[model samples]
Target: MSSTLLAKPQMRGLLGKRLRFHIFGAFAVSLGVVALYKFGVAEPRKRAYADYYKNFDATKEYEAMKQAGVFHCVRPRE
Candidate 1:
């Protein structure tokens, strides 16, 4: 009981310092995770999709689909 009474003030100060450290550490970690995912995952996917479409023959596929009557000319837009 006497030890608890004497430790209250010290505990309060330690709590404040630890709380600040925890908050800042959490923020830094979250930012790092987001940056790593963007660079490692999202950017690579975008580049792969661009590469795939770079050599895709859009006009030839469109002509084939049109010849096969796979499309409906519902009021062509200008």
Candidate 2:
């Protein structure tokens, strides 16, 4: 009816007023989400990985794989 409300100057002016707040709101939301992910998932996963490697015996695993004949050297294509 009224040429799509978006074409109205009043609407544009309203959007301009709230545009900065919207941008700031989006930024705040994204930053909060990232912080939550880092604390809830990434940090815990990193800590778990560090703990796993800390007590891990790489030599034992390599020897076990060697004994099982599971280790193989791939030849390069010449």
lDDT of 1 by residue, 19-61 (tens): 8999999999999999999999999999999999999999898
Return the clash pairs for model 2, or none.
none
Model 1 global lDDT (CA atoms, 0 to 1): 0.86
Q: Which stretches of candidate 2 lie over 4 Å from their true place?
A: 1-12, 73-78
lDDT of 2 by residue, 1-78 (tens): 677666535644787779889999999999999999999999999999999999999989877777777857733235
Highest TM-score against the true fold, candidate: 2
- Top lDDT prediction, candidate number: 1
TM-score per candidate, chains pooled: 0.62, 0.70
**Model 2 CA RMSD to the hidden true structure, in angstroms:** 9.0
Task: Please give me the total number of clashing residue pairs in predicted model 1.
Answer: 0
The alpha-carbon RMSD values of the candidates against the true structure, listed in the order shown, are 5.3, 9.0
Q: Quote the positional error of residue 8 for candidate 1 in Å.
A: 5.4
